[model samples]
Target: MALPAPTTAPTTAERIRSACARAGGAMLAVEGLEPAPTPVHHLLDDGSFATTVPVDSALAATAVSAGAAGVHAVLELTDHAPLPLREPVRSLVWIQGRLRDVPMREVPALLDLVAAAEPNPALLQVNSGITDSGTTTEPEIRYALLRLEIESIVVADSTGAESVPLSALLGADPDPFCAMESCWLQHMESAHRDVVDRLASRLPMTLRRGRVRPLGLDRYGVQLRVEGDDGDHDVRLSFAKPVDDVTGLSQAIRVLMGCPFLNGLRARGV
Candidate 1:
């Protein structure tokens, strides 16, 4: 007989892409070099990644040597809750691929693609020509843009681990609320304990024994992490249906809490 299915609403591919988009930290590991600290990066829609490293750093030198053959590398991305909850990490995405430097001629176009997805200031600092002392000078290359051509992607979280196909990952879109989820969840945890209690009430009696905290939120539902003596339990309080906008999310959340008077989330904050 087949085993029971896991929650099917957010497919593995969707979860991988969404987690990558919202990842708070990233580390790149090449064959011989130590894991480089790469906090800012972007996962392009094409299932590849774009990141930067100091032009004079060892990693940049390694990439330059790799050239066309490309170096075997793994990029690990981590998604953590904004709140200081126990077991803060929500998910991990590992991309095993070939890493190479983006040709200087193509750097401009690659930056454009990365900027469109996530305009990190670090990217600007690379081409800004401003020295570490903040003095203006001729445009200088302070960083080297690198690309990871993905070979495979695997995502692991409370749910489990799964290998996602490149096509599926390319086709998937990040959660609509991914960028804002941290703020909203932070607001709920700090200001709306009553609402969280109400939502926790929906869980089974056994699960109610733990310390419940907001774990994550998506367009489909709110996730709560119950930290008990045995371990942590992640429960998804799904919306009656998938919601598209903040108004719908607010209504769905209110309905789940059985509190109709709850206010809507603001554009900038909750």
Candidate 2:
């Protein structure tokens, strides 16, 4: 017997994506554009991998334009707890969930903004640690692969061998490359991945993981999550405004890349 269709509204991510938002701001952030990323190369000389960093697409022209238009709305990921009073109405908010620290520099600002914007801030059990340079460099590298959209490239190695050859190890380029992102981006990326992975597993229904790359803040609708699902899926609607230009958005993102926070709930286990 076919069960009657469930009557509840679609999840926030869903609603905005078409189950809510619309085509221009669907489940994806950088639709038909590019992905943000960094890369690491395993030197033939040594087993160690060196990073060739690419920038994030969330800071892309599309994202910036959407954000500025106030179309970039996000839904706070909360576990149905009592929310703070000063909820944000702009375009973003703090989701209540077991937040994996993404290590943004202006974390305090983001949190303050969320506190001001969101109402019922609940919590969820999610990956609590964080993503730093060492962990998610590959994703950034993936962004670099696009080649067309990418403007600059930064290659860094904690081992410091990429710039300073493992052999010579001296008198290498004294200054860092133009493409380099501060260490903080790595940490924030880690947080981004953890949430993405968990959501892929947790959502009652979702399009596909490969299509989406939760870049953070969707037109003030879904917080900490962005969908870019591929194949057979309606472009998830994102009620976000554009970032005007990717370069400016990327610059602003650079500023917010490692903000810290005191999450209300600290889950016991993974």
Which tens-of-lDDT digit does each residue in 103-177 have in candidate 2?
A: 335334433433352221210101112355446322212211111121111222111211112333111211111
- Identify the runs in model 2 with alpha carbons over 4 angstroms from their true place: 1-188, 202-206, 209-211, 216-219, 223-263, 267-270
Q: Each model's TM-score?
A: 0.87, 0.18
Which pairs clash inside model 1? none
lDDT of 1 by residue, 190-228 (tens): 999997999999999999999999988887888999999
After TM-score superposition, the amount by which residue 211's alpha carbon in candidate 1 deviates from its true location, in angstroms, is 0.8
**True-structure RMSD, every candidate:** 5.3, 24.5
Q: Which candidate is the best by lDDT?
A: 1
